[model samples]
Target chain A: MTGETVMFWVLAPLTVFAAVGMLLVKKAVHSAILLAFVMIALAIFYIAQDAPFLGIVQIVVYTGAVMMLFLFILMLVGVDSSDSLVETIKGLRGVAITTSLAFAAALTSLIARAEFGQEPLGLVSANANGNVEGIANLIFRQYVWAFEVISALLITAALGAMVLAHSPKSSEARLSQRARSVARFRGASIGTAAGLPGSGVFARHNAVDVPALLPDGKPSDLSISSVLAERGDVQETKRYALDGLPKLDEEDK
Target chain B: MTEYASLLLDDPIWLVAVKALLIFVLCVLLTLLAIWGERRIVARMQLRVGPNRVGPFGLVQGLADGVKLALKEDLIPKAADKVIFIIAPIISASTCFLAFAVIPMTGKVLFFGEETVFQLTDLSVGVLYILAAASVGVYGIVLAGWSSGSTYPLLGGLRSSAQVISYEIAMGLSFVAVFMYAGSMSTSEIVDSQAQWWNVVVLFPSFVIYVISMIGETNRAPFDLAEAEGELVGGFHTEYSSLKFALFFLAEYVNIMAVSALATTLFLGGPAAPPGLSFTESWLGGWFTFIWFILKVALFFFLFVWLRGTLPRLRYDQFMKFGWKVLIPVNIAWILIVATLRLMTQEGASQFMLAGFIITVVVLVMLATTIYESSKAKAEAAARFVPEMPEPSFPVPELPKQKRVEL
Candidate 1:
């Protein structure tokens, strides 16, 4: 066999194995990193075609930026929970394997059967520049709008992520207020709600008026701090109020 | 057939591998030499002896240090991600070494009864390869930080990763100008493109942008926010010890050397002597260009040391802002200018007319922008500071002749 065929055999398995490894990885982050390996393998495949520009772009854009973004999103959402297996299905697994195998079989047969072969164009020929400039020249002239729309979509995704990540100003303030009110209501005179302590739905001489926007809107005085206390960890964040510094230490008593 | 296999058949695999190995070794030695040179030069500047305890005016100081570092007790923190921690330094060192494969240290020399370049190898996509190598080094730092299971190291790694991404965009934009001028990315062909005149002259703006990017790329001051000593304490290598620590150190120096070598190759006309000095004559053999190349690299090496000594470290935000805001935008503008000039030249425009027109246009644009921005900024500054009119100060503090005590 020619060296080209030998090289192809070596590289083809690498790409397929890496891609399969990427898909089969249990941890999402590991999967993403494996996908980078697959992208690098594919980049090498492009190198075999002498499409160096596409090869570099494949590695740079896919492995570098997009995968990094995916990893970041996974980290932000906190992967590695037992909830991941909640979507697992035995029937889907069988179908996935069968379909993927069939697809691979069809693709390989098509490749093997094709009589198409190419030789590198001469140095001064039209194909010499790897179509980077030529494609750009044509693309900007024709599909510029689509390219811009893709860019806009990316911007929108970025903005959406930013919006989702940010806590609304009013809700955080409301939570902080709830915690502070709990601290304020540890008095003996108040009609404390159902709890072990004298803390909760307090009444000062028959005056127990709690704010709306808490659970179920009515002034059932369901006691916001009691709810937060049940939740546990958010107490520190509740203490992240406007100068809870002195009062928080007092509440510990 | 001529194109497909002639190049491969010209040189045997063993010979090429040997050259590759030699290039790797040479780059390491170059890095060692650079570290020593910087210490000695900085010491001289500060009027002190540097590394005199080592062999012969501290000539082997770097070697001694390397050996000492290897002998130190290796400490892997209990909390670090063990696999990534182990892999990080290797990744760092390997990527830094890979960039030199395409850098022609000398022109074609006769080897093994065939003509083969002194370079390890040259690919059509050599420039992008260097970019990839440099970019991969960022991951090593990132991995180092993340693996360490320490806060400061992680911060250092993240900062470095961001810094790499920020600077790389500007660096890529700068390459567009070079590509437009040379019409190729192959390093050897790039050098050949500069056979008439160096790209450093025609693409000076690109070279400048690349210089800025290189400084940021190598994490030189004032761009070394990744390892800011005051804030990060040892930065990404904080948790590393012994051979691992040494690898990170070696990687840092190797990257510095790689960038200097790249600058030498790209702008200083890779192994070629300056204008008027031709090694084409038989008296000056092909091997001699390597000397000139080394000297150019040494000059850049000195510049790196000089920057470290001279510039204060920039704030992290300011560093990123400089890369993304100033450098990338300026680079894009420069690429446009370079492309326009290329178009003009290819269309048979006279060099003098083009230069004159470009200069006038640039000067006018710069002047107009400066006036607009400065005027706008002046008002903003006035509004912010709101400087009140100053009254003459009385030394007695307007206390109405209270107590003549100069005591």
Candidate 2:
């Protein structure tokens, strides 16, 4: 077998497995990652098939930009958000299964009836100048109209996203830096005028979980982060107080 | 496949393995040297002593650090994703080395009596392959951050992915100018086309854009917001320890070298000698060209170090704004001009026409920028104007007279 054949055999199974795993993965992030794997594998297949331009574009546009964005949104939404599996619409599962089976059967029959040789027809002549130039010629000449339409569609999609995301400024005039500073200084309590003390300030222990100590030997509530406090990860300062520690000489006895 | 690719295709299996091994060693060695050089250079810039302990001039400091890291206790956070946490660093380290495959480090040379180019494989879309490798490299960072199951890592991961994705567009757009000039994406062909003049001279704007984008793409200062130490506390690797942390570090340095080498290939004309010293290319059976390649790559590495030493990390919002609003738009405009110029030249436009076209475009761009700047300034001034202050409604308190007593 040729190297390409060997590579195809090695990668084809892995690609299928990854693609299937993408659907089965519990976490949305995992599914996204599996899909990325499948996309990359498909890119390799393209390169192996002598379509290096398509292969690299696959990786760049799909795995790189699109999948990264997918993962980014998943991260923002929370990685623990998994496939619901719950049927939101009535008879949705039945419809999905029927459609997928019909599509698979149609695909199989079409491939079986296709009049192609065992060996792939390589793009050796078409890519005589270079794969990039060959693809460029096709894109700018033969498929120019389609390409233009696709670009228009992309621009419209981008505009739609921007419009959806854009939030109109409120009627209230935005506060200037000077106004913000003046308001802060003139506010109800002057305690946080400079800013709240950072966590672990004057606490000896510099970890974020430790709250700063007040002058009256009390822990300052404002010093520790609310997140840590709410998570119950805060360390009690009394345990590390100097008075509570054993003396070195007493420990020797 | 191009000539270099056909040459690579004729390679024996053993020779191919050797080439792969050589590329692997080159990358790892470059990573180590980059780490050492960055420290020494930054130290000099800061007027401080860098690593001088262990091997002479601390040349093996990176190696020593690697060993120490290996020997240290490996820690996995209780809440971390076990499988992905383990795979993340491996993915990070591997994808970085993959980019070197398409990067031609030298011209034809004899490797164990086999004539081969000093590259693993030269795909027709070689440059795109590098970009693909870089894009895949992002997964390593993102996954490391996510699988760590911590807040800081997640934030750092998101920042890095966003930064890389934003900058990759500008970087890709910059390459379009070079592709136009060379008329091919294969690394070797591009290098060959630059025999007369380097792309750095012909495509200066693209070079500048690529340099800036590469810096941001690699997450180096002043674009290192993703792993800002003051904020993220070691960023995505906060939850990692020992060897896993080392793998991330390795990947970071390897990525630096990868992009630097790519910059050298695209802008500095690959492994070609200096213009005046072009004769030296055929010297030593074409092996000396590898030295020139190293020198060019080293120059870029120094630039990376210099920027890191001189600049401060940018604010996240401002950095994002600069990438999207500044770098990308400029890059797109440059690409359009380049494409039009290429088209005109190919259509056999007269010299006078080409010059006039270029001059008109330049003047128009300048005028548009000036107008845009003036309008923006006016809007900013209007926004800064504060309304007239009103007099206090309540009466002001009178100061006590002659209350001070001299001691």
Candidate 3:
């Protein structure tokens, strides 16, 4: 194998492996990180192809932008421990393994039929790396339609992503909230005592610690600060959360 | 390709690696300096010293601050996802640093006996590489925000991801015009093809689009919603402390410098002297080429600084609308115009006829733009003149109320 070919074969499998691993990863955030490794490897592949621009674009766009979006979303939604791959595929393991093997077999056949070129193509050697002048001629005349098609695809994808990113949290909460919110009053019984601040996650979801309505239905603006202050003040805040979890354990046992 | 004895040996892998390392270091240094320069320049524009003390000329101030950040206890919020919290910044910093490998700073230079291109590598799909790199860079911000396991950071990351995506399309389209005009996407080839007229001149519309898109892509001022200092409170990096925060900052500034360098290369001509000087045979010509490159890059850098100082950040909605409604569509129309020009040239159409067609297209575009601007302005004025709506007792959240809890 040529140095270029050697570089590519080694890197390409790693890239594909990482990308597949990203798909298989349980934690959404971890999946995003795996996707980044795949993206970086793909960029190296682009560099090997003598397409530095595309490699940079791959890194900048897929690794930087798209994966970041995925990560942000995972973060935004709160880590979905429920979506853990192992957990998701618990019952489907046998079928999944069979399907994956079938897919791999088909892929191998396709690769086996591909023709090999005798020599490595280089921007320097061939001056035929067929860059600006070559692409200009080809794009203007031959591949113009393909170019426009890609642009259209990009436009739709951009809009779709934006819409998805901005999706409201309403349906998620209303539909799945009760099942998932678990509020961990789980099969594990909770103490009847409710006044201890961090009995549950202690409002990890919201930072907006405003006042509540009094029993008399009067506004209690004064209590907002007082309540919030007491939650943290002379009494150390960290202990409440640490202390809260064990209390549930005690009640359950 | 002629193999360089200096570079081909095992020792030189380390050497090239060292050089690459130096370039990365220089880029980060430049970014910090640019940040300081931007502040000081803006302060001068507004009549103030940006960051005096810490060191003379505040020269050492950026460095001093960097050292201070390093010395400070690296605080990992107890709530943050520990592994990702560490990895995200590395991704951002490394990707930004890697982008420089392809940018031709001073064109070809002698190394040992062989002629060597100043670029780290060339690729037929070079432009696409850049786009991909930038896309990956966003992950760092988004992941950092998400892994922080904090509300604000998550929100900031989400917003940033959206912002980058929205602008990236326009940025890609902007490059299409360059690709069309130059014919190749290779950095060196594109630079070479602009032997006569820098694509900036021939493809001025594309140049304008690229300039706008580059700013938006880099998340510069007026478009920096990802880390909106005012609202998100340092945005994605809000949960970060010490070296983590510095990495994010370094990535931001380094990316800024990379994009500026890219703009200078693509539009202004990479490392080549300006048209007149490159062609001139004087010993001064070669010397001047390096000088011209730095000058051009500096100018573009200054523009970034100026925009940060002058423009207030756009509202998130308006920013997206501008990208989708204005920039993308306008780029499409401009591409059509460029396509027509390319067709005419290919068909061996008469120069006069082509010129007339071009003139007509230019006039129509300008007229349309003017009419659109007037209508937009008129709408703005009419809205302002109309009575403001009474404050609602409870302003409806833009997001669905059900989301209020999940969010």
Candidate 4:
């Protein structure tokens, strides 16, 4: 097989698998990652098809910008939040299945009927004056209005987001609150004293200011102590508390 | 494909493999040298002695570290996603190598009785290919963080992804001017276009922006907040150990080299000799151009190390703000001016007049905006003024004065 054919065969299946995996993956993060893989695969496919401009655009725009945004949002939301399996709306799953099946069938039929070897009308070969120039020509000349409209739509979307998220009165109130907090903080010593507990069992000082010492003369409520206590591994704790602090004897009380 | 690039495809399979192998070896050796150089340079900057034990001047210290890492016990956190944890470092290290594939090391050189460019491969969209590879490298870090199932790592990964995305936008915008000037994205073609003047000379603003964005993009010092040791404690690789950790380290240094090479390719004219220098060209039978390329790349590497030694990491918010607000907007404006000038010059217009006109317009617009912004700020300050509060109704208790004791 030719290199292009070989590449197509490899990348096409991988792309399909990744697309399917994106839906099948339980974790939202994994799905987002799989979508990125799909995008990269599609970009390779574009390159193999001699459309270097489209391939690069696919990578730069879809895989790089959009998928990164998706992953960013997903990670921020936390990976523990998996996709809910429950059907929120009655008959929604059925509707989805039906629509997807119909769409798939329509797409399959359209592809099967399409001419594979012939170049499309008004579309220049990628080798002619470079793919970038050819694509630019098409974009700025033939499809200029559509491109402009799409860009305008993006701007409008951004505006709508601002309108939805912003409120002048609330923002002003928040700003005033923030100013007050800042003033309060400035009036006091910029220390951890504000977070200290008032009292504790071994309270010589505030709990947050000074960690309480346990009867064993080890610091109480430390991360190591908590983790060890949770795991019920007290024997392992001795290795961690090897700082050579004197242990409190029972008679010393 | 351009004639320069076409020859690359016509190379025999074994030659291509040899070139790929050479690139791999060069990247690794550069990473090692960079590590040693960074340590030695930073130590000198700090007035301290660096590694001098392993080999002469600690040149083999990187090798020692590699051996040490390989010998160390590999540890996987109990909660980590096993598959992803394994794949993450591989992704990082591989992508670092991938970006070097299109970087031309030298002009046409005789290879076993055939002329070929000193590069692995040349794509039509070579620069974009590098960018794509760099972008994909983000995945390795993000995945490593997420798969660790830890807090600091997740935060680091998130920070890095956001940082990469923000900087990538600026970096891409900066490239637009270079593309306009070069009239092609292919690295070899760009190098050819720089026969008269390097892109850095013509597209100074883009170069500046690219340098800043490259630093941010590579997550080097001053922009390495993702792995800020003071806060994140090793960051995304916190949960990794042994060879995996080494992979992350290797990827980091390789990324530095790749980015430096890219800057060399795009701005410093990619293996081309400096203008009006022909003595060195004949000294090594024309192989001296490769040395020039290496020197330019090394200079960039030194700059990276110097910044690391001199500067402190930027706060995350400030870094993001600079990337999105300052670098990107400035890059866009610069690109617009450059593109206009290029079009005018191409159409037989006076280059000086067109450039001057664009610069004048840009300056006037900037001045107008600055004045308007300052006035608006003054108005806001006036509007935000608050009257002082009256005295409290309840009497405040006064503390008793401490008795003065003189020692």
Write down the C-alpha DockQ for each prediction.
0.06, 0.20, 0.16, 0.17
Worst 10 residues of 2 chain B by lDDT: B391-400
Candidate 2, which segments miss by more than 4 Å at Cα? A87-130, A171-175, A178-253, B1-9, B390-407
Cα lDDT tens digits for candidate 1, A1-253:
9776888899888878878887686666566656767777788777676566778777777766676566545544542321265547668877878999999999999998987479754534644445466456656878899988999999999999999999877642232444434443443323332342222234222222222122222232233445554655222322212222233334445
Best by TM-score: 2
Runs in model 3 with CA error above 4 Å?
A1-24, A39-76, A80-253, B1-22, B52-56, B107-117, B275-287, B366-407
The candidate with the higher lDDT, 3 or 4, is: 4
C-alpha lDDT (0 to 100) for residue B18 of candidate 1? 84
- Reference interface contacts recovered per candidate: 0.06, 0.37, 0.35, 0.26
The per-residue C-alpha lDDT of model 3 at residue B353 equals 89
How much native contact recovery, as a fraction, does model 3 achieve? 0.35
Model 2: per-residue Cα lDDT at residue B65 = 82
Q: What is the TM-score of chain B in candidate 1?
A: 0.89
Worst 10 residues of 4 chain B by lDDT: B391-400
Clashing pairs in 1: none
Best-matching candidate per lDDT: 2
Which order, best to worst by TM-score? Answer: 2, 4, 1, 3
| Per-residue C-alpha lDDT of model 3 across residues A120-218, encoded as one tens digit per residue | 655675436444444456677789999899999999999999998895766532323343223323322222123222312233323334333333233
**Local distance difference test values of all predictions, in order:** 0.72, 0.86, 0.71, 0.82
Tens-place lDDT per residue, model 2, B318-355, is 99999999998988888889899889989999999999
Clashes of 2: 0
| Decoy 3 TM-score against native | 0.70
